[model samples]
Target: MPSATLRQPPSIPKWGRPKQTTKKLDWAEIKVIDLSTYDEPNGKQKLAEELRDAVHHTGFFSVTGTGLTQEEIERQYDIGQAYFDLPLEEKGDPKYRCDFAKGNYFGYRAANEKKIMGTAVLDNVESLNIPKFIPSNSHEPFPHFLHPFRPEIESFSRRSLDIASKIFTLFSLILELPETYFSDQHRYDDASEDHLRYMMYHPRPAADDAKVQNTWSRAHTDFGSLTLLWSQDVAGLQLKTPAGEWKYVPPVPNGIICNVGDTLSFWSAGYFKSTIHRVIRPPEDQAHIHRLGLFYFVRPGNEVDIKPVASPLLRRLGLVGEDAEEREPVRGLEYVRERVKDYHDHGDYADKKGKKFKVRNLEIEDEAS
Candidate 1:
């Protein structure tokens, strides 16, 4: 395992972020909040302030020195690579395939099982997505040899959840609310379709940069609260700038890239930036090799009421108005199902449309951020 200590700047990023700026972000300037700082007095508060600024303006940042060790991340990656190495038949057994027609995407997503939205091409991505794990009773038993890795994966999930909880606390402070405000709505025992995904983006011959508009994933915003991405050297991930251009998100060593999501932005009364991002063809240098992405999507608990927070900060900024248009409230579990349905062919077993709530119309043309 490589060291998490690749590079260090004690309190801030190596590059400069201009104040009173919101567009044409320099990914190199993105803040990296070292979680270990929380041990110092007022460290959490300081980190929260920096985090709030990053989420509101850039919508993405990184965290170094997270509680999870580098070895754990490497081990999980090794486990995922092993899982992906299985024969197609074994991985595609009915038990593991995502029956999207039923709106369920909790298991294996075969490389050929997906079609990109608004594109005729079948996606070059395959992934294993595991949902919130309950320690008391486990299900969906894997092959005998893989059982040993399950505990490791579960432990990783728990550690990631711990990091999410800490960030939620920082968010609470940033919003001038009680530290437990967001935590209460995200209890682990509560059923939310939050996922820990191990995704692989298969490589291809380099495409002409001028001709490839949507080479891999189409531009989109994530539908959860926060996405915790374990660092990878893969350089295909790009984020849309306020200036309407795509820029690659340069990889940071041992840095878990964090991004604000739709739920968090909505909760903040659209104050937080739910930046649009996409995956494109890799650079010419590495287009011949597969790229692996590891992510943990942190979703709120199922029954948590997701609506605009009555934050004084948002009010001061005039983000929410007395007569402002409103979107339907989202309950966590149902929201996950609805979001996945848009990108997959979930079967009838999933909610089609229901009393739970309609999926909010989040069209790109209508997007604010």
Candidate 2:
């Protein structure tokens, strides 16, 4: 009898964390919230009080005790690095690429494909956005190499959202609304633009960076409700301070950096900030390293209206008018989809410094300086 054929197990990629930069840099003093206290009595309220100043002032903070193990986080980084290491032909296959024209972001975005700020220097950031694993998104395309890791990816994605929901509860408490107010609008099983992203920024020549004022990614606010960035030590991310100065967002060991986004700010009637942030070339010592990032962006449900909520605090502060509910409504999906198209369906990252992007009554300045 012929010998039976043998099958080989699929290979898993290996990745190690990059060493921290030895050079001292100007780091932003962002507050860190410990989620371990979340389940204790009055824990949510206490955490909300701690987070109040950070959200109201800087719109940026970090979280720890999130129940995500170091090993689990590293596994995600490994998967991201491996996917980015594949040949362009395989990673950038048309079937798996982002459909920016139609406002679909659930796929790969190849690096250096377009010029930045109208300069000859190309954009060096590449990313893969994985949609929620719910059945509705089953039709979305993902790179074949990632198929074997689906179960773990799905688990990570769901857990990230769960952590976000706890944060949402804190936000609601701060706003004097029902604890579930924000979370209800962002159900994981519901259809939304939420994504688990793996992003990489390749270093460019110093001269090329200068052409765009050393901007690796231009200044802009995130479009969703909340953004969770897993801490990494590459040292290029910066946030524009309220006083108009830029400061590096320091890495929090084993913590996740969280930021409020446009929708969240809108929902809170501007009580919660949606700060502008950007990526610049790393400090000279770390400039040659590729900055890898893992993130989960939470968006409101597709059919959910993004109208400012009727908060008691807003009413007391006169931030929301008696006729606030009478204003035209902007659905969550509509705004995000349009924002995605306006920002990405372009040949170049031209400077839109004073332009305004409006949807219904909601509008934001295109501060991509």
Candidate 3:
């Protein structure tokens, strides 16, 4: 008998980048770090010094020369757009939905599932979080629509981490520690909450948007160590400045925006700033367009202790005391799971202005105006 032939998966349609908004909005002065020189003798140190002010003050910046081509980045976006285009019943299968009550955020999240700001207007954002491609995560639910592109998705996920690893090295150098200190704690093979996310914000009527303060997403800090967001054109992302001003985060062509998160801030004993950010309805020029986003959220290894690092700078600044090492330990997974639950288990996106979300000794303001 003749051997059977193997079947190949269908290809995903191409996705084009959207045109930028024409509105002259207030833009933030975010510094851009070029990584092309990262392999030079003193490159890492130089980059570290350049990045110091941004991390300490704004907690946001952009990166260029990451060696990822526009074609490769757009391919991932195409895959994500195709997945979101599937029918609700097919894409939002019960088995693949996120288990927020259990603090598991590894699957699909449908849009408009809950009300916003105690109003009748439902949340306008939807997202799908794909965990790291490791054997330990094989048991997690994955969408069947994306199975065909697994190889490409896996490669993209790993490459995103490689870029993040370089940034981590810069952080370590900035703290005057071994270059690999932060990267080692975020090994890709380890079981953690790291995810490559595909998210979208649908447009709502202006009247309904007004009812919810025009917030597509509430103001809050990210829950991980670091976040990498691939730049896209539809406008609405804004970051809160130390001066309490909300300025738009402008998109850089072929560049990735980076930000510090709660865990990194915790590990540095408040030395690293975790700035608050949110998405609002796009300006009238782009309000009808859907805002698609690609992101990689980096979490420390599940077993790594999240206590304040023993950095000389932190010590000299009095951010960490001699007994810092003796403080009760909180593992990476423990804090992340608790945070997911605290942010998502509720039935509505009520006003949480004065609320505090705590995990052990680390706590962050749950909401911002």
What are the lDDT scores of the predictions, listed in order? Answer: 0.68, 0.91, 0.91
Model 3 lDDT on a 0 to 1 scale: 0.91
Candidate 3 error regions (>4 Å)? 1-7
Q: Check candidate 1 and list the clashing pairs.
A: 100-345, 100-346, 100-347, 101-345, 101-346, 101-347, 102-346, 102-347
How many pairs of residues in model 1 come into backbone collision?
Answer: 8
| Each prediction's TM-score versus the true structure | 0.82, 0.96, 0.97
Reference-based TM-score, model 2 = 0.96
Candidate numbers, best lDDT first, in rank order: 3, 2, 1
Give the top-scoring candidate (TM-score): 3
Better structure of 1 and 3 per TM-score: 3
Better of 1 and 3 by lDDT: 3
Q: What is candidate 2's local distance difference test score?
A: 0.91
Error at 171, model 3, angstroms: 0.5
> Mind giving the per-residue lDDT tens digits that candidate 2 earns over 93-194?
999998999888889999999999877899999999999988788788867778777778888999999999999999999999999999999999999999
